[model samples]
Structure formats: C-alpha cells, structure tokens
Target: MMRRPGLALKLSVLLMLGVVGAMVVDFSLTSGTDMDRARVLVFVSIALAMALLAAVVLDTLIIRPLVRLSAQARRMEDRGYAEPFVPTGLDEPRELGEALEHLRQRVLAEREELQRLNAELERRVEERSLALAAAQRALVEGERLVAVGRLGAGVAHEVNNPAGVILGRAGLLLDDAATPEAAEDLRVIMRQAERIREITGALLRLGRPSRGERGAVDLAAVARSAMELARHEAVARGVTLELSCQASEVDADAAALEQVAYNLIRNAVQASQEGGVVRLHVAGSTLSVSDTGSGIAPEAIPHLFEPFFTTKKLGEGTGLGLAVAHGIVRDHGGTLTAENLPERGARFVVRLG
Candidate 1:
C-alpha cells in the first residue's frame, strides 16, 4: 500500500520549492548587476520568513490543539467523563470540544438513570419470584389434601356397613341382657359403635355433594344451635364457648350451615386447653371460629381440612370434622379457610356469598 505524506513533510517540500524558485530568479536578475549579494540576501530572508510563518501557523492551528484533544480523549476513555473538555485553539477545535463535552455529560446522566432503573427492575423481579413460589406451595398442598380426602372416603365407605351391623347387634344385646353388668357392657359397646357411625357419616358428607334444601337461613341462629350442640363437648373439655356477634342471614341450607358451625366449634373446643375460650363470630355473610389454644402446627396446616388428617391423639378424633365442614361450606357457594392466630390458637373463617 502507498503511504500518504504527513502535514510536516508537505510543508517542508513547499518551503524547499519556494527557496529554489527565489534562487533561480536572483541568478537571472543579478547576473549583470553588482547587486547580486543584495538579491541573494533578500531571497534568503524571504524564504526564511516564509518557513518560520508556516511552522508557527501549523503549530498554532493544528499541532498544539490536536495534542490537547488527543489527551482529553484518552482521559475520557480511561477514567470516564469525570471532567468536561476545555476548548482551545481555533473556532473549529473549540466547537468540537464543546460538542464532545455535551455528549459526555448526556451519556453519563443516561448511564446513571439506567442503573437506577435496573435496580428497580431487579427488586420487582425478586418480589414476583417470591409470590410465585408461595403460590406454587399452596397449589401443591391443595393437591395433596384432595388425594388424602379421596383415600379416606373410600376407607370410610368400606367400614360403614360392618360398623352399622355391630351397632345394631349391640343395641339388641343391650335390650336382652341377663344382668345389669351385661346390660352396661352392651351399652358401652353400642356407644362406641355409634361413635364409629358418626365418623363414617362425616366421611360420607366429605365425599358426597350436599342434597339439602336451601332457604333463607339466619346464620346467628345456626351459630346458636351449633354452640349448644358443642356445649357438652366444651364442658367435658373444660373449654368455654362464646358467641360474639348479632344476626346475619344467607340463602343456604340451614342444616348444612348448622353442621358446619358445629364441626368447627367442636374442633376448636377439642384443640383448646382446659379453661380456654372458643369465640364464634357471625358478621354479615361471614362466620368465624377463633380458639384460644396453641396454634396449629405449621406442617399440619396444609392438611388440616383433609379427611383422616387430625392433629389430635388417636381414638380421640376421626379427623373428618373440618373436611365435612369445608365441603358443606363449599356446597353452599361459600369459602372456608383456616389460619393460625399471631398470638395464640387458630381461626376458621366461613364466607357465604
């Protein structure tokens, strides 16, 4: 490839041409005159002055400003736009410097703003990720509870006929007992068999859809009846049941609602410590049972409404209470949810729409 001549080389060539032309003119004009020395001096002086002027102009207009601008560009590349460009030299160079300065400032401002926006975007992403994780956990728990309820329903169905037969025979034996002790023993067998029937009934309720008739039902009255039904259990457990709200009505099956409230209140009483209180709250379209006992176990919360998933000791509970209650509420076009209280115990809320 051919190399181009630099500015300094071009200037030097022009100066040499000027000197040669001046020498030729002097030789021709002063060859017949005694002013040859004067002509030579004049030519030399003019060439020297032209060379000096060219050097000064090149240095002032191009070389010095170019060096400064290069240094400024290097500083910006190495350390970023920490300082503004200071213009020097001719108008063109000064305007170029100003333009560069403006661009640097704008770029720096945009970069900072972009950083801020990136930080905000990251925060939002983290929040959404946490929410998604929580939702996934809830969905998994719901699926597991459904699976358990289906299994429990099948087992309960298989055991129902045998339990009914035992209960029937025990009732017959109690009536024909030869002695008082035999009658008492037979009575005990019948009572135990009745408890089994109750459990199987709850399981059937959980597994099947409600066929109860719907009517305008007063929730407060239902709550009262539920409280009365649970009164004996509460007294046995030494727990107090309290009603804390006025009348509320909904278009639902009164028996279903009553059963739901009875199950919830009974479970609360059973979970409570002796002398603890279970409060029943009935507001417009909502009923809640809050118990003053140790809150539910964190690991058990997911399975709380599942049939046969009980935190109570074996033989003390059949675990179908909340499952049946949940089904009943759902059949009434309502929602039932349970949560642990912050300070103590647990709360079950039913919303009728």
Candidate 2:
C-alpha cells in the first residue's frame, strides 16, 4: 500500500515553496536596484515568520482535530460504546466528527438489541431441551408399565390356584389339630395363605383390563364418594379433608373412576401429618388430590405407579393402589400424573376428557 503524506508534511512543503518564491522575487527586484544585504535578510525573516504562524493555525484548527477524531473512531471499534465521541475544531472537521459520533450511537443500540435477541434465543432453546427430555422419560415409563401389566396378569393367574389350596388345607388342619401349639401353627399357615390370596387378588386387579361400561360419570360425585370413604381415616389421623367440587362429567366407568379417587385420597390421608390438609379439587374433568405431607422422595417418584414399588413400610402397603389408578386413567384415555408441590407435599392430577 502506498502511504500518503500527512497534513503537517504537506503544509510544511507548501510553506517552504512560498518562502523560496519570496526570496526569488526579492532577488529579481533587487537586481535592478541598490538593495542592501541587511534589507534582503529582513524581508526573508518576515516571510519565514508568516509561514510559521500559518503552520500553527493549521495544526490547531485542522490537523490536530482530524488526528484526534481518527483516534476516537479506532477506540470506538475496539471498546464498544463505553466512551462518547465529542466533536471539535473548525466547521468541516467538526461536522465529520459529529457524523462519526452519530454512527457510534446507532451501532451501540444495534449491538445491545442483538445481544438481547441472542439471550432470548438461548433461553428458548434451553426450555425446549428440558421439555424434550421429560417427554422421552414419560414414553419410557409408559412402555415399562405396559410390560409390567402383562407380566402381572400372568403371574397372578398362576399364583391364585396354589394360594387358595394352601388356605383350604391350612384351615382343615387347624380344625383337626390335637394340641394348642399345633392349632397355632396351622393358624399361622392359614393366615399367611390368606395374605398370599390377598396379594394375588391385588395383582389381578392391577393387571386386569381397566376398560369398563362407559357412561357419563360426574367427577365431582366420584370425588365426593371417595372423600366420604376416606373421612374416617382422615378423622382418625387428625387430618383435614378439603373438597372443592364442580359438576364436571366425563365419559368413563363410574366405579373405576371412584376407585381411582378413593385410592388417591387414601394415600393422601396416610401420607399427611396430624392437622395437615388433604385437598381434593374436582373441576372440568380434572381431579387433583394434594396432601400437606413431606413431598415424595425424588428418587421414588419414577416408580410411584409401578406395581409392588412402595414407599410404605413392609406389610403396610401392597403398592398396587397407584398402579391400578394409573391403569384405570389410561384405559379411560386420560392421564394421571404425580408431582411434588413447590411449597410442600405432593399432588396427583387426573385429567380426563
């Protein structure tokens, strides 16, 4: 690239040319007259002073201001809009500086807008990522539940026959026992057999086809029935049952829906502390049961609706309640979801249409 001469150098060259011209003119005019050497020297000195003054004026009004303005533009490119560009000097340079300053302001505004848009895009992407992950988890869970149901149905059928036989034989032995210890032993065997039968019954229920006679069933009424059934347990536990029902009807099996409501309410009652509130709200084909207990454990939430997956103490729960409820809701072409509340406790929502 060719480097151009700066304003200072160009002005200096012009001033030197003018001085030479003045000296030449003095020599030419003096050639025809008796001009003294002192007089010629004085005239040359005056020309030199005028050139110096012109140089000073140009530097102050044009050269120095243009240099400052150029430096300011470079700084603006490097450092963003942190500094203001102040216009200075004579009309032409000042106008140019003002134009550059205006450009800096516009660029700054555009840069800020671009930054805001980028931030918004990032936030939306993050949200979509989270939603996609949740959807994948739900899909896997649904497949697992289907497999569990098929297996449970087969297992329950196979186990039911032997369980009944054991109970029958134990009962006969208990009646024929000759000693108190023998009778007691037989009783224990019968009791265990009875428990086995109960377990098998629950498994069958969980695995059975949930679709039943469909009718217009008012969810509020079903919720009210469940609330009544749980009223005694709630009272015994010193838990308050709060019901807010709307006359919302859904095409579903009344008995199955009631069972779902009952199971959810029962679980909520059992989970709550004394004096804790158990809220049952039914509105517009949606029923939610919320309990003011310690929220469900995060690790246990995924398996909450899986058969035999219980958080309750051993022997206290068969763990088929939620599984059955989920199956019923699914068969009704609805969804049953459980979530921990932000403040405290857990909420189970059943949405039907």
Instruction: List ranges where model 1 is wrong by over 4 Å.
Output: 1-158, 179-181
lDDT scores of the candidates, listed in order: 0.80, 0.83
Per-residue accuracy of model 1 over 101-180 as CA lDDT, tens digit each: 88888999999999999999999999999989977875675566556656766877998899999999988887889999
Off by over 4 Å in 2: 1-63, 90-95, 160-198
Q: Give the C-alpha lDDT of model 1.
A: 0.80
Q: Which has the greatest TM-score?
A: 2
Clashes of each: 0, 0
How far residue 17's Cα lies from its native spot in candidate 2, in Å, is 18
TM-score of 2: 0.73
* List of clashing residue pairs for candidate 2: none
Would you estimate the TM-scores of all the predictions? 0.60, 0.73
State the RMSD for candidate 2: 7.2
